[model samples]
Target: MAEGGIVRVRHCGAAIFCRRAPARCPACGSPLRGAGLPAAPVRLPGPFRHGHRQPRALLLRPAAGTFLGGYDGRSDLHVGVSSSQGVVYNYDEEGVHRAETGWEQCISIPLVQPDMFGLLQQWDKLLEEFSAGEDWLPHRYDEHDHNCYTYALAFVNSVLTAQGKQQMSKSEFTERFVIPRTKQASRYLTLHQELTAKDFYIVPLPDGENQG
Candidate 1:
């Protein structure tokens, strides 16, 4: 596993690789590493990471799994709740199948921290938007992208309402999750974007937001 519990896809030559396994290269019977090939700034995810957005921009990230959901304090203030429609149900056969009967799920994860501040920022350079300077210093970068998919927020009110702790209100809900007016220069720098936040969060996830 990685230093943290972050597990991501790796590429070796023309093949994709994974760090933990039983997983083998589809082309060869070898283990994988996230750093298997080249690591480029363009390879890095997020323009926000490139100093794009104004600071105080809090982002949200969602936590998603195949069959279950749980709380993760290791993440930002927001918690995300999501469900997937299995690819097995789609008849087009265009989706890649991990197994014969199992369908790949496209899960929607939300982040309530700020721009480029969650797991989705860990995007493939060939697959994602580019940012400069992440490579100019040669410091090791967090593989996790400052994005929403991995840094999803579950919303303080969303969880409470679902758990019967906080009553649901349209006004209260909207006020809590929408974008805020604050520091406009330092949002979405790395993992745990919430840690640097000094203001109240307007997390969008229903069960998202609470300072630890």
Candidate 2:
């Protein structure tokens, strides 16, 4: 085993990478470090390379009541526009806000990566339209009509249309992608028994004091 390096713990013939050299394995919580110990390979960061970086669209789900909680279980959607360097734009209610903590889950949308400059220009144009009190920015937010879900749908469709791709509606996107992804993530935890494991834990907050 290498110091401060990745390690794997084997239990029931199954093994998983151990983030740290815990006193017991994270998988089975057994004190068997050398039982299935194997040499870990060294990984080093590489220099940045120039290319047409993929543009990402992340759907962020925050805790309930973080924004207006009505339609879906999730509160709001934050679109993260990223490149090779890192996240360039984290579009939210504050309008092109910087990426920060607070999101509970992030669902990525599948779309062809467009030119970085072109994408930036498109976002800039959208911001201009928003500032001009255009149709892009709904006058008010309604649960069933206008809300964060609608805003995200509009933003994504705008980018897709600008890239000559077919547009999608909020319902279609939610049913086909968002809902299914959320279910999958939920199932993963249950399948792994993370909710009942002795070592599994989550700090609880006082009632009425929770924030997204």
Candidate 3:
């Protein structure tokens, strides 16, 4: 696999999207010696009509600790995050959608920098503090070009917080993320409408980006 890429796992006759790394597998009992992370839009447990569209959001692996999925070509909004450890997760639109955890339960968190749950917790509160709050996340997601925006931003800020690259009040964070998304929605939405479900995925291979 390339330095930052994902691969799909054919586990128990099912596919799972995983973040790629140079060493070990975060999913099942395995190592990444020759393994890679799968691409997005994978078929996992979901609420929507799922056949093979890129996920709106990805949930964190209990082992990967504090991370989630990444971008796909289908998204109007896009981001690529890489940790110093060479771990990478692509946050695309659909992956974001799949990342939902209802009011009562939440995913297990790992020892992440800055904070994973903290940012999520903060955003949850910020949404309540805002004017248009009902299903605000789903709306903001629709306004953007992809589904992965919420958690991607979370990943970015968490990485930044860990690295001391940036900081912001809740308003500042919202201002920074929302403006670009609202503005760029016109650009990526058409792409989103055109691409089908299969368009978002690719098995991460050694130097895979250069191949067909």
The model with the greatest TM-score is: 2
Provide the lowest-lDDT 10-residue window in model 3.
Answer: 102-111
Looking at model 1, residue 71 earns an lDDT score of 21
Candidate 2 Cα outliers beyond 4 Å, as residue runs: 1-8, 13-31, 37-56, 63-116, 130-139, 175-197, 200-212
Ranking by lDDT: 2, 3, 1
Q: Considering every candidate listed, which one attains the maximal lDDT?
A: 2
Candidate 3 residue-wise lDDT, 1-212, digit = tens:
12113334443223434333223333344553444333222222321111112122222221221111223323343332222222333343233222222211112112234445564445433322331333224434543443343444555455456556775554675575444443343333222332223333222445434221
Query: What would the per-residue lDDT of candidate 2 be over residues 1-212, giving only the tens digit for each residue?
Result: 22223333334344344334456545456665455332222232111111123334444444343221222433444444333333334433344433434332344453434556666555645533543444433345455665555655676677777779899977787798677766654433332343233333233345453322
Off by over 4 Å in 3: 1-150, 187-212
Prediction 2 global C-alpha lDDT: 0.44
Q: What's the true lDDT of residue 10 in model 1?
A: 30
Q: TM-score of each candidate?
A: 0.17, 0.47, 0.21
